[model samples]
Each structure stands twice: as structure tokens, then as C-alpha cells.
Target: MSVVASMGRKEKAQGAEPSIAPLIELAGPDMERVNALILDMAGSNADMIPEIARHLIDSGGKRLRPLLTLAAAKAFGYEGDNHVKLAASVEFMHTATLLHDDVVDESEMRRGKLSARMLWGNQASVLVGDYLLGQAFRMMVEVGSLDALRVLSDAAAVIAEGEVMQLAAAKNIETEEAAYLRVINAKTAALFAAACEVGPIIAGSAPEMRAAYSAYGTNLGLAFQLVDDALDYGGSSMTLGKRVGDDFREGKVTLPVVLAIRAGDARERAFWKRTIEDGAIEDGDLDRAIGLLRAHGAIAETVSRAKAYGEAAVAALSATPAGPYRDALVGVVAFCVSRVS
Candidate 1:
């Protein structure tokens, strides 16, 4: 079977979401350290702090960002504990964003469970997310590399900015594809780039190597987000954690929606405006929406675009030291875009 088929079978047999198990296995020893640090830092006397934090932290989403950090460090032959700190910090930052995102999106579900906001309330979720951010910064400082600190800190700012941009673009039927790319680039890809770059930086790799990893991560991130957006329409709820068409219900304009909107005729345009911009959704709208997307080949086109970025991610690794870690990184790109299959 092909890689995608093999992955699909594994997921079905295990009754789990598709995973980057190869990368995780490759970084097993380091990931154990990262997990321990995560649990350690998640502790709190406030009770609710750790409660709310762990609720989301223990969610089943694969720790892909942190894995990238550990794998990158391993690829560069780093033999220090700083990568552990950085990896934990990367995970904290990612978790914090997820907490905040669920609240902002008013999402009811996350990773196959009720969202933190649904369980605790928006106020508690936001505060716990803030607490995670504080802990993440502290971890970055403990690593004691100003360059690593700068990279992660910058990514934090970019992620917040991306959230705001997505909010602005929300329900705006006129949002362009470039605008969509920018939102996902900052919201998602920025962290991926930072996670990978910090590894090389802490490993004392040359600047050229750092840039190569950053490029690899950025492109990989872009592809990952595109596939996710497509999956929101085409994938099963078991695969997505939340119900499919959450984006449609929320009126979030992703790349597929963008392409569909641009190609739609007068009647189709009215349908998009009413359902997406105006949120006047009704039964069968989702099926109709899927029909429109298929009619325009938006889903296929989005996957095609993802494949291009995946190729770029593989190309960015040309300067990365050749080894198993390097090969696994390339496989990560393949696995990311293959979710659609």
C-alpha cells in the first residue's frame, strides 16, 4: 500500500487519529523529557489552573510542533538539555494558542472532547491560556539562548497577529487567497518555523542551516494548514475531532471557500453571502457547500498547492545534515499533506 493507505489503515486499526508516529518514534528519548517537563510546568496550587491547563494539554492532538524542535536538535547532533526546555516551551505556546482559539471561535468541541471553554468558561480558559504563555516565556528564558528567545517570542507575536487577522477576515466574503495564506502563515506556520529554528540555534548550527530549517518548517506549516482546511470539509468527524463543516458554520473563509467564492456565479455568490457572510445557514447548506467546492475543484486545488509547499519543505532540507532525522523530517511533510487521501 501507499503511505496514505498505510496510514489510513493504521488509524482505523488503532481507532485513533492519523499520527506522525515515525517522527515521534525517532525522537522518543527526547520527547520523554519534553513530556516530563510539560507535566512539571503544568502543576499549580491554584487547582483550577492546572486542571484547565491539563484538560487541553492532555488532548489527543499530536505534539507535532515540539517534535519538530526535538527532531531538529537531534538532526544537528545536539547533546544538551536545552532542547528539552525549548521543546517544552514550544508545546506550551501551542497549547496556549489552542485554548485561546477555542474561546475566540466559540468552539464547542476540540480534539474529540468538549472544549475547555465549554467545561470551565471563557474567562477561565483565557486566564489559563495566559498562564501557559507566562510559563512558556519562563522556559524560553531558562534555555538562556537570546537568539532562541527572540525567535519564539517573535512567533508568539505573529501568532496573536494572525488570530486577529483571521478574526477580521471572518465572514468577509471578499477575503482574498493571499490574505488567507498570510493568516495561516502567521497563525500556524510561524510557530512551526520557530520550533524548528530554535533547535538548530541551540545546537550551534550555522546560520545557513538555521535558515534552511526555518524555510522547511514554514513551507511544511503552510501545507499542513491547507490540508487541515480541506479536511474540515472532506474529512470525518473522527478524523477532525470536531464536526466537519465547523468552518462553514463559523463563516470562516479558508482557501477552498475563497476559491469557491471567486468562481461562483450570481446565484452561487448569493448563496455564499447569505450562508457565509450573513450566517443565514439552513439544512442541506453544508452538502451544497461541498458541492460548490467540488464543482470548482477547490479541494483538489488546495491539496495541489499543499503538495507544492511540501516539495519546498523537502527542498529546504538540502543543507540539513543527511541522516535518519533528516529523512524523517521529509516524511513529516509527506504525512502532513497525505491526510486528505
Candidate 2:
């Protein structure tokens, strides 16, 4: 069954399996600190900056990235408050990226509501994003760990480069799978890796432990993005937050489309070009695209790839000392892959 169907059945039935509640509960106390820091830092002398920042920050997000940071720190028994600052920094960076991404993608909605650029003008969104970046840097510096600073600052640069690469690849149906992976690694996975790594660094763990956590986050992030791409075509708006086929409408060259195009015939190739490259889509084109993906087994294969990454993420946790926090991290990997069921 598709993930949406499975979740629907659970929601409608008794004795449903648990979701990520355990992970959330494990990180609850620290997450409250992280949330408080986020709100405090989001304030500014300029009211508009805070207004725009709060609009997106206060949106109903899972806050998964920051939670991962907290979870990693707690797993290692870190005794300091630096993790709170770092978690807040991670969230600020993520929020900044979303604000800028919506503007770049010319997206109409975010988190099932009008995007900040839609409510405020694009210029306001862009400036507020810059402000958020500034705030993120401030928080990172306040942590006063050069290693942590290097990791996060490098991720920020890589993420910007990835966005540019994605822009170059956009609407290009011939974009290769390797190139697509590069985009996602830098765009999405780098921050996840960095977020996890900062925890061990702040905790004063050894290099090997730090590397393991980073590896875990990177693989988990790959799995997370792949599921999101698959859901874009297969999931409902209720499940996916944004509309179904948002990636298709934006002509973004995600993995499922990449596999489908490589396996597609000449007629299918022409169809992809007309819609994705030429932006000449008509009604029912999304249905045709989904049909092509399913016919080629692209969706299933993509999910298979995600599961492989998910497994790798689980394996990366092997060296960490076993505890509830470690178990919660493992559960997070399951949650990441189960988004597609």
C-alpha cells in the first residue's frame, strides 16, 4: 500500500501504530529550549524583519532538523547549553533557506499556506531571509566553537551552491542522476549532516563518533528527500503539505522523473520535453507523468533507493553507545523511510 493509504487506515482505525511521538517526547525538554531561543532570536529592532521571520518560523513544521541536533547532544550526554544555541542556529538557517527558496522557485504556497513572498512582496521576503542568515551566524558565533562554526558555515556555502546548481539543472530533462544526487546532497543532506555533527563536537566526543553521527544524518537526509520526491507525485496535499505534483509543475528534475525519463521511449521522451523542458503542460499531464513513472517502476525503485539509504543511516549508529537517545535516533530513521510506507 502507498504511504498515504497506510496512514489513512491507521488514522481511521483503532490500535494504530505510533508515529514520531516517541522521538518528539525524548527531545521535548531541549526542544522547548530550542523553541524559546528561536523566538527570542527572531525578535529584532526592525518590526517588519521579526514579522516576516515569525510568519514562516511559527508555521506548523516538525522542527526535525533542530530536534536532531538536540537528540544527538542528549544521546552523548552533553552538559552545556551550547546545543541550544546550535539548534536554534540550525533552525534559523533552515528557515532562511525556505524563504529564499520560495522566492527562487516562484512558489505560491508553503506549508499549505500562502508563501511569504505571496503575502509580503518578494523583496521583503529576500531581505528577511538575509536577516535570518545574519541571526544564524550570530547564534553560531555565540556558541564559540570554531569546529562547529566551520561545519555549519561550510554547509551554508554548499547549500547556496547547490541552489545555483539546481537552478542550472531546472527544466533540463537530460540532467543526469549523479548530478541530481549532487544537488540533493548539497541542498538537503549537508545541513542534516552538519546539524548532527555539531552535537558530538559540542559534547567533546572523539572524531570517529562525530563522523558516525554525520554519516547517519547524511544518509537519513537522502532517504528523506527521496521520499518527499516520490510523495510529490503519489501523495495527497493533506499528506504532502504543498499540492501534489508541485515538483512536476516547477519542472524540477527529481530522482523519480530522472529514472522514468531514462527508461522512457521516444514518445515518452517527447512528452517529457514538451512538459518539463518546454513548460507546455496541459490538464492531465501530471496524471500522464505519474502513469509513466509507475509504468517504468520508477516510484518503487526510488523508494527502494531510499530504503537503502535508510539502512545505511541505521548502520552508522552501530558505534554509538546504546541508550534511549540512540534508540530514538534509530526510530527516526524508521520514521524517515516510513513516510513512503
Candidate 3:
């Protein structure tokens, strides 16, 4: 049940065409409106906030948060302008998190460019992130949906809590799996749930359908994060648009390393103690750690968990009617896992 091996999708779709093309194609029509809304939401008037805010936005993330909103809304037959505002709000919140995350993680690069904190300094990054959150809240209010606003507000709170938890857990090798789930569920899954739920809420969908979308997005976020954890310990750094071994260097307990710590032999335990626990591993330590992960089946086990989450994401779509949007939603989860692996 290695994560990559357990995904139930047909192969060869990964060959010539991008696995996410179907999702991108299905979401193409809403792109213009989404782009326009994002710009409007991002456009702000603060002394230095706009510069800090624009740094990562210009670095070109895929805006998958908004895409999730649009796809879910389309699946449920939403044809209103409110969805646009809601989608833009989700993007704004996501960007704000990235800004604060860089500051907290003390990250130097993001999306292969200097982080906002790097470009504008921490004070500017923090202020600008706050400004963006304010703007996102404004848009949420403008949408005139109490449910959507509450969802976003709670998500913002949860995201902050998750960040704090991660900061506390840093370099602490004994951090539990439950702790990891708590951090990721808030830091990652909250917004993802809001992104999908906002669409259904705007569409005035059935309760079951709304719940389905939330479950789908939540599971997808968890899967997305598991793959990310695996990649930080497993993927080539240059290919991932960031330096390799960042989590290791920072002493973060990503899934692969966590599994390796539990399942690895004495040498592997020594590697974790030196690199992760002691924070004193040298050159090739990262490579050797990755090697151990592969040899001990830790990486495979972690990915299997990711794939199970992916399968749950796919099954969540069963509550939605059969449509291109539904298939694309399922496909995106697979693509999210594969793209990282």
C-alpha cells in the first residue's frame, strides 16, 4: 500500500499529457473571472503592504485554492458572481499564509524566488500579510454570506494555531503522529475545506453535497501535504524549486522521516538522532537518509497513507453527480500526489 502504488487511477495519463490538464481544461472557462477577482482582491492601499503582498503572487503559484472553489461550484451548478468573490477571498487568505509562513519558517526562497520577508524584511512581510488578511475579510463581507465569512474566519484562526504548533514542534524528534495531524489539519486542510465548501455554500447546494466537497478538499489537502513531507525528505531539491533537505535541516518531522524513525534500524536511528534530533548531520547525510527511507519501506508506507487519503478524496466525489467537473476533481488529487513523487 505504498502511496504511489495504491492510487487507483489508470496509468499512461501520466505519459505525454500532464495529469492535471483535465482539471486545468475543465477550469479554463472560469480562469478569466478568477484572475480578475484575484487582482481586485490583491490590489490594496498600504504604505508597503502591496510590495510585500505582490512578491509571492508574482512568483506564480498555481492558484489551486481558487480553482478548487470554481470546480466545486461548477459541479453543483453555481452560476453566480458571489462564487468569484469567495474564490478570490480564498486565494488572498492562502497568499497571506505563505507570507507569514516564510517569516515563521525563516525561509529564504519561495516558488523559486526570494521570499517577501527576504525582499521586504520580516516587519514588512508580517504587516503586509495582515493587510492581505484584512482585505480578504473585506471581500468575504462583500460577498454578503455569513456562512462563508464564518468559514474563512475560522479557517484563518485554525491556520494560525497550526503555524504556532509547528513552530513549537520544530527540532523535537519525538513529535507524535497525532501532533502532525493536528498541525496539518489546521495549517493545510482548513483552507482547503473552506475553498471547496465556499463553492457549495454559494451554490446553495444540499447539505450532503456541501459536506462531500468539504471532505473531498480536506482529504486532498492531507494527501497534498503528505506528498510534500515525503518530497522534502525524498525529492531532488532543484527539481522541487527549493533547496533539498530543508525539513531535515530545520528538524521538521515530515512523514517519511517519521516513519523511518519508527521503522529504521540502529544506523537509521543514529541518522535521525544526528540529523534530526541532534541537528548535526553533515554533507551526504540527506542522501543517506533518503537511501534508508527507500530501503526500509518508510517512504512507501508514507505514500500509501497519502494514496488512501487520495482514494477518500475520490470517493468523496461520489456524492456529486457524474460530470466532467467531478472527474477532474478526482484527477487533481492523483496529480497532486504524482507531481510531487
Candidate 4:
């Protein structure tokens, strides 16, 4: 039976079974080093802006974004201080995006606590986010790789475009899978692709290897996002750092909702049309939407696609020489598709 048809019949975690433990083990020392650098970047300023920034940073996120950058660099055999600086910069870029996202989405809570916007208001959240972005750029420039700067800048631009695309897609119920991919690639995977690509580019690895990490990151990011979309319909608010079904509440047509709209029969279609398009979702809309998602097979379809794409991500790691870093890179495939939160 399709996963959608089997919903309410299966364990909740089974719906999105990504295992971060393996990824965490693989990250090891590098991950700890990552924490220290991020703390340094945020500093200890005792002000609302800094407090908001620090609050968000200390919210116990997985910190997978910059970890990918560092792991990819190490996999390519780059033993230098430059990657560390660049990795921190990349993380700042990601955190800045989150801060801005919360503000843009008008989110009240994050990681089970008040969001930066919730605590300090939207203006402070927006400006601090901008500060993080500026710091990211400043650090990137110091790395002295015009190549890195070019890639990161382009990624940032793409992220912005993707966010705009999603904003446009929010109220539109006819969103296609292609459009969905474009939005996610721009908003989330653009940086993932950049993270992996720069590893080899900075290390002076061959062109093929550079391309491999780039592809790997892109695929991993795609898989990651697909799982995330599914989880939004089911995962705990505390775990996802946002309320469950927040996307739906915001009028976004995620894969499940899109597919449900496409595959649902006449009556089901009307429900989506009313809820997703007409913005008439009510108190019980979440349960009803989950039912629609199952009826349309969108949930299972999304997971199937995530698994396939995750496999492709691991395959892209072949260009890296054999080693623990390579193994970790490859192992991320399992992590991507199976992640629960």
C-alpha cells in the first residue's frame, strides 16, 4: 500500500526515518570544533540584537550545513586553516538565512522557544540577520579564493530567488513538482552544493572531483528537503524547531499537498482547493490534510523520491579518494532520507 494510504497505521517516525546518529558519529571532532567557531562568531554581546542572534544559535540545531563544508574539504585532503574560517563563514550564511526566514514567515516560536522575532520583534531579527550575512561575506573574502567568493555569492543569490519563488508558490495550489524542486534548490540546496564544491576547489582537487561534491551536496539537499516537507505534516514541533503543519498554515503547497491536489479524486480535490487555495483551513484541517496526502499517495511518493536522490548523493562521493571522510560523505545518504526531524 502507498505510505499515504497507510498513514495512522504506521509509526510516526517511520514516516521520516533519517538517523542523525551515524552522521553525528562521522562528524565527531569536526563537529565540536564547529561549535566553538560558531560561538566565537556570535561573541558575548549583552544586547537585544546579540541576544536574539545568540538565542537562535544556541537553540540546539543539528548544524549540518557547515559540517558538510568541513567534511567535504577534509575528504579532499585539504589540511589548512583556511577551510575552518570558510566553514564558519558558510555556517553564518546559513544561520542568517534562518533568522531572515523566521522574520519573513512571521514565526513566533523556534526550537520550542520564542524565536528571535518573537523576542526582539521583526526589525531586530531582520537587521541581525543582515549582520550575519555581512560577516559571512567579510570572512569569505578573507579566504582569498575569488573562486570561493564567486560560488558563495551566486549561492546566496540563488537562495534569495528560491525564497521568492516559495513566497509566490505559497498561495498557489497548482504548484508542480518541477517548480517545487527549483524553489528548494535555490533556498536550501544551493548552499549545500556550494559547500561540497568548494572543498575540492580550495584543495586544488581535479575538476571532476569538484563537480562530484557539488552534485553530491545538491542531491543530499534535495533529499533532505523532501523528507523535511513530509515531516512538517507529522514531526514534533520541538524537533523541527517550528510548529507542525506550519507550511500548510502559511499556505505553502509542499510536495504532499501538491501531489494530493493532483492525485486526489473529485471530492478530495475540492478539499484541497478550499483549504490549500482558498485559505479556508480550519481547526481540524491538519488531520484532514494528512488524510488527503495519504489518499493521493504524495507522502510515499515523496519518500521514494528522497531515497532515490539520497542514493545519488552517495554515488557522487566516488570522486573523493577512499577514506573516513569519504565514507561519511557517502553515509549521509542514509541520514538524508531517514531523518525524523
The candidates, ranked best first by TM-score, are 2, 1, 3, 4
In TM-score terms, candidate 1 sits at 0.94
Give me the runs in candidate 3 sitting further than 4 Å from their true place: 1-18, 265-267
The runs of at least 3 residues in candidate 2 whose Cα sits more than 4 Å from the true structure, single-residue gaps closed, are 1-18
Backbone clashes counted, model 2: 0
TM-score of each: 0.94, 0.95, 0.92, 0.90
Report the C-alpha lDDT of model 1 over 16-96, residue by residue, as the tens digit: 654477788899998898999999998999999989878887878889999999999989999999999999999999999
Candidate 2 lDDT tens digits, 64-138 = 899899988888999899999999999999999999999999999888988999999899999999988899999
> What is residue 227's positional error in candidate 2, in angstroms?
0.3
lDDT of 3 by residue, 25-47 (tens): 87787867877766666666664
lDDT of 4 by residue, 162-203 (tens): 989988987787789899889998998899999888888889
Instruction: Show how many residue pairs clash in every candidate, following the order shown.
Output: 0, 0, 3, 4
Name the 10 consecutive residues with the lowest summed lDDT in model 3: 1-10
CA lDDT of each prediction against the hidden true structure: 0.91, 0.89, 0.80, 0.78
